[model samples]
Each structure stands twice: as structure tokens, then as C-alpha cells.
Target: MSASAGSPGGAARSLRSLRDLYDQAVELPAEERERFVAALESAGSSHCAQLRRLLAAADPSAESPLDDDPWARVEEEEGPEPVPERIGPYRILSE
Candidate 1:
């Protein structure tokens, strides 16, 4: 897409505008961030697509890396689940 495909500004101008916009947003209090973003969207924010994705990624509630982790993410992604547990009357209790 052009720097400012939908607006009168050129691509380079749009990049600079978005850079400044993000910088401003990051400077606001965290509590006010959502309101700031909402105000932008209500005013037909042009950078909604990028803002939405960045916000999702920045959400603290989102999943995070674990400490003392031994396995790789690829390992979990590629590994198969354990087999279903089975029970019988004679099942041994010893560990």
C-alpha cells in the first residue's frame, strides 16, 4: 500500500505520521491508552489495522514465556498428546 493510500499525504509522510502517533500514544498513562485509542477509532483512525495488531501483542493478559522452561516452543507444537488413561480392576498402585 502507498504510504498514504487513502489520504492526500504520500507514503513517506504517512510513515512519519504513524511514527509520531505511536510515540504519542506510548507516552500517555497506561490507563488512558484505551481511551486514546478509542477516540482515534471513533474519529476514523487510519492506522487501525496496525494499531489493533500492536495492541493485541502488547496486552499483558496475553500468554507469556515461562521461567525455568526446558522445552522449545517448536517441541510443543510438534509433539503428540499423551495416550488416554486406562483402568482395570488389577491396576497396580505402586509408584
Candidate 2:
């Protein structure tokens, strides 16, 4: 039997489905996204409103976090670390 929305499993499944839908929606071109959401709404999808809100909040022009090198800032702020001449008992000869 299918789990009811009130059940924990059902809630988890609903969330996963919504997340998948949001991912799919975000991949569509901006011009086509409205029609994608409209189709969902016309079909009486439970996720229609939440999906719309997600799409509305998305900034297509914003740079993705992955596009930046996080280490670049650390290097700029702290500079490069000096190579160690020796460890506790061993000498660092190379690199």
C-alpha cells in the first residue's frame, strides 16, 4: 500500500520528488521554464507552488560556487605556506 502524506516515509519521498523536480526545472532554458511549471500546475501537481517559488528565487546570472577556486582566497589572504626544512625526526629534502 502507498504511504500517506502524514507518514515519515511519505514525507521523505515527497521531499525527494520535489528536489528532483526542482533540479529538472532549473536545467531548462529560462524561456521554457514557465511552460514547464505551467504544465505541472495544469496537471494539478502538488509541487507546483514550491517549484515556482524555487524557480523565482534562482538567479541564472549568479556565478556557481563550484566555478571559483576556494583556495585562491586563502592564498591571497595568508600567502603561500613555506616548505618545512625538517619534520620531527626526518629532514624534508624535496618539495
Candidate 3:
């Protein structure tokens, strides 16, 4: 059955379509991506701006959240922990 625009199924389909568009756009060379986005805009696709932003964020040269270790700063601020003197039956020696 076909989903109406306001239905949950319709929303899912729209999300799927956007994901598919993103996948396709991401695979294109950087130089060609602008043209692809422009084409979508010219076609009056509501997702064009969102797709452009997604493409920009996915660009290889763009800084990625994964590039930095989030915990690194916390670790630096906390510094290294001191070794415990003893544990249960064994005495702690070297770190």
C-alpha cells in the first residue's frame, strides 16, 4: 500500500530517500558534488540544503569528530594516576 505524505511509512521512505541521496552524493568526486547538489536544488527538491550540508560534513578534508580523541583532553587534565602501594596478597612493585 502507498504511504500518504504525513504517515510514518512516508517519513521512513523520505529518510531512506535522503540516505540514498547522501550515499550517492558522497561517492561522487568532490568537484562534482556541487553540480549534483545544484541539480537537486534546480529540481526543487526539499532535501537539497540538507543534502549539501551532509556532503560538506562528509568531505574528506573537513575535520571529523573521530579525528580527535574526546577523552584525551580529560586524561591530560587529570594526569596519570599514582600506583597503589599494595593489593590483597601482593605488594605493588613497578607501574
lDDT of 1 by residue, 1-95 (tens): 65445576686677776777777777787788778788888999797667656666666677766533656665678796544444565554543
- Residue pairs clashing, model 1: 3-11
Clashing pairs in 3: none
Score candidate 2 by lDDT: 0.89
Question: For model 1, what is the error of residue 25's alpha carbon versus the real structure, in angstroms, after optimal superposition?
Answer: 0.8
| TM-score for candidate 2 | 0.59
Q: Of the candidates shown, which would achieve the greatest lDDT relative to the real structure?
A: 2
Candidate 3, residue 61: how far the Cα is off, in Å: 0.6
Candidate 2 local Cα displacement, residue 34, angstroms: 1.0
**What are the lDDT scores of the predictions, listed in order?**
0.69, 0.89, 0.88
Write down the TM-score of every candidate. 0.51, 0.59, 0.62
True-vs-predicted CA distance for residue 40, candidate 2, Å: 0.8
Better of 2 and 3 by TM-score: 3
Candidate number that wins on lDDT, 1 or 3: 3
Candidates in descending TM-score order: 3, 2, 1
Report per-prediction Cα RMSD to one decimal: 10.1, 5.6, 3.5
Off by over 4 Å in 3: 64-95
